[model samples]
Target: MSVRPVVRQLFRIEQLVDMLLALTGKEISRLQQILRSGTVVYHYYRYWWEGFEAVTEDLQVLLAKFPDADPSQAFRAEQCTAAAIEQAETQAPAKKMEVEIPREAASRKRLLRARSLWECLMQLAHENIPAYKTYSYGRHADIYVWEILPDVRGRLEKAVERFAPRELRAPLRRILQSSGALRLRFFVPR
Candidate 1:
């Protein structure tokens, strides 16, 4: 089935965040700050990698559905774009030399940290969970409805209908109990 592009992008970002956490054992607050500001260089690199994967997957699915079509022709435009990005990444210096060694060294240090973060995410994704499960989180208690039922959207709609501002806490608890949404529980102590 074709996934929505926005959902795919959100899933990729979630994966990137998970990878960052696994790699550095960094605080969630710091990661949230990085995502919020969109300033970190590594975030750009990770997003590029995820975008490449999404495009590649889209190409694969389209080709599978239409084997006779020249998929390469469709993908040529993206291929060119990917090539340009690769070239830019390769030519870009870790830091400009005119500043000083310390600043340049710091940039190199951050880049290395980002690489390690990416590696950890890859390792986690490969080890214990299916690719789709990589995007799952505890806060989204409604995810269980999607997992268990065929009519996920319908179930979510019903839940939203029954939802009330005052009754939220108890209803959420009941839903969690009924759905077993907390099965893959992991504790991250503050």
Candidate 2:
């Protein structure tokens, strides 16, 4: 077996590894953006929940204006009804429960995945090519700048910007700095 062919094979393998690292970094950045955005939405709902009590009270008062109303008939007839009022009240708690539980769960899962990817990127950064680490953060910035659907990303960006600093921002920034990607903007401004 010739040494030249073996060397060529090794070079190809190294290139392949490099490519995979780039892709992984990009994926990490994308996931970070997503996770951060999800965090924003979670907080928005939390804030909404905070105001929900007042909203429910107001709704109850509005329904009380029509004491003799059949809530189901009101809803079905586009008028106020007791049954519809009851149903709305009953559903409010369930809706709130759904919002709190699933949104939080999904947000947490996205954060976990993003953190795992960040850890992987950090590990890769410690290797010979540190570019991947920088690339990872840059890719996240790009997704925030581009790619992300505007309406959704706008709300997400706002939510993430509002919620991130206390949670993941500082740690992620420190990690990026440690990895030599100091110029990367991973956190949305508070």
- Candidate 1, residues 33-62, lDDT tens digits: the string is 555554334432334231222244443443
Stretches of candidate 1 above 4 Å error? 1-11, 22-24, 43-190
Candidate 1: 10-residue stretch with minimal lDDT:
78-87
Models 1 onward score TM values of 0.18, 0.15
Cα lDDT, all candidates? 0.28, 0.25
Scored by lDDT, model 2 comes in at 0.25
Q: State candidate 1's TM-score.
A: 0.18
Q: Report the Cα RMSD per candidate.
A: 24.1, 28.3
Per-structure clash totals for the candidates? 1, 10
Candidate closest to the true structure, highest lDDT: 1
- Name the lDDT value of residue 10 in candidate 1: 46
Model 2 clashing residue pairs (backbone):
40-159, 69-82, 70-81, 70-82, 71-81, 71-82, 71-83, 71-84, 72-84, 74-79
